[model samples]
Target: AQSVAQPEDQVNVAEGNPLTVKCTYSVSGNPYLFWYVQYPNRGLQFLLKYITGDNLVKGSYGFEAEFNKSQTSFHLKKPSALVSDSALYFCAVRDRADYKLSFGAGTTVTVRA
Candidate 1:
């Protein structure tokens, strides 16, 4: 079975501060990891993906993630948070061969002005 867990329900950060959202996973084989952001009443937008190679992957909007294979974790990070970055985030994973993704419940990121 493949699954992802987002330990935080929400993360609140002030503008210009670093931010992080935790994520852990369990899967039978190599996993295709992905991060997505969703705004109010909108579908999820792709943030980044970790398929292979690099442990540190960068994505849209100054976002990045570190893939820790030994720990089975892929946590999202940003050097400087923004008010516009406040949105719902979801961590997802799929088996090496399967296209069906299993997503975390989601974490709401609230960036204060």
Candidate 2:
């Protein structure tokens, strides 16, 4: 079985400061990690994915993630935060045998002016 954990329920950041959302996972085999952002009343939008390659992967909206296999963690980071960047972020993992992705509870980011 594969599972993902978002340790924090919410992250608050200043408008111009950086932000990070942490995620950890457990899987039987190699894990396929992904990050998605959801706006109010809208579907989740793909942010980035770490399939295979360099440990560092960059994605939409100036977001990047570092895949640390040893730690079983994939944390999303943004150099500069924005008020519009406030939304719900989710970390997901896909198991080799499963066709669907299992998502974390979700982390809500609040950017204060």
Candidate 3:
């Protein structure tokens, strides 16, 4: 079985400061990791993915994630966060053997000016 965990329930950051959302996963084999963000009353939007290749993957909205195989982690990071970056973030993982995806409980990010 595959599962993802967001250790922090919430993360707070100020405008123009670095923001990070922690995530770790466990899978039977190699995993397909993904990060998604959802704003109020909106569906989850794909932020980035680590399907293969580089250890660092960049995605929408100036976000990027580093895939650490040994640590089983794929934390999302933004060098400078904006007030608009505040949202609910999710970390998901899918095993190559399965079609379903397992998601974390979600972490809420609050960015203030």
Candidate 2 per-residue lDDT over residues 1-113, each given as its tens digit: 99999999999999999999999999999889999999999999999999999999999989999999999999999999999999999999998778989999999999999
TM-score to native of every candidate shown: 0.98, 0.98, 0.99
- Which regions of candidate 3 fall more than 4 Å away from where they truly are? none
Candidate 3 lDDT over 2-113, as tens digits, reads 9999999999999999999999999999999999999999999999999999999999999999999999999999999999999999999999889999999999999999
Could you tell me which residue pairs clash in candidate 1?
none
TM-score of candidate 2 against the unseen true structure: 0.98
Candidate 1 on 44-84: residue-level lDDT in tens?
99999998998999999999999999999999999999999
Model 2 bad stretches (over 4 Å): none
Q: Predict model 3's lDDT versus the native.
A: 0.97
Q: What RMSD does each model have against the real structure?
A: 0.5, 0.7, 0.5
Output the lDDT of residue 40, model 3: 97
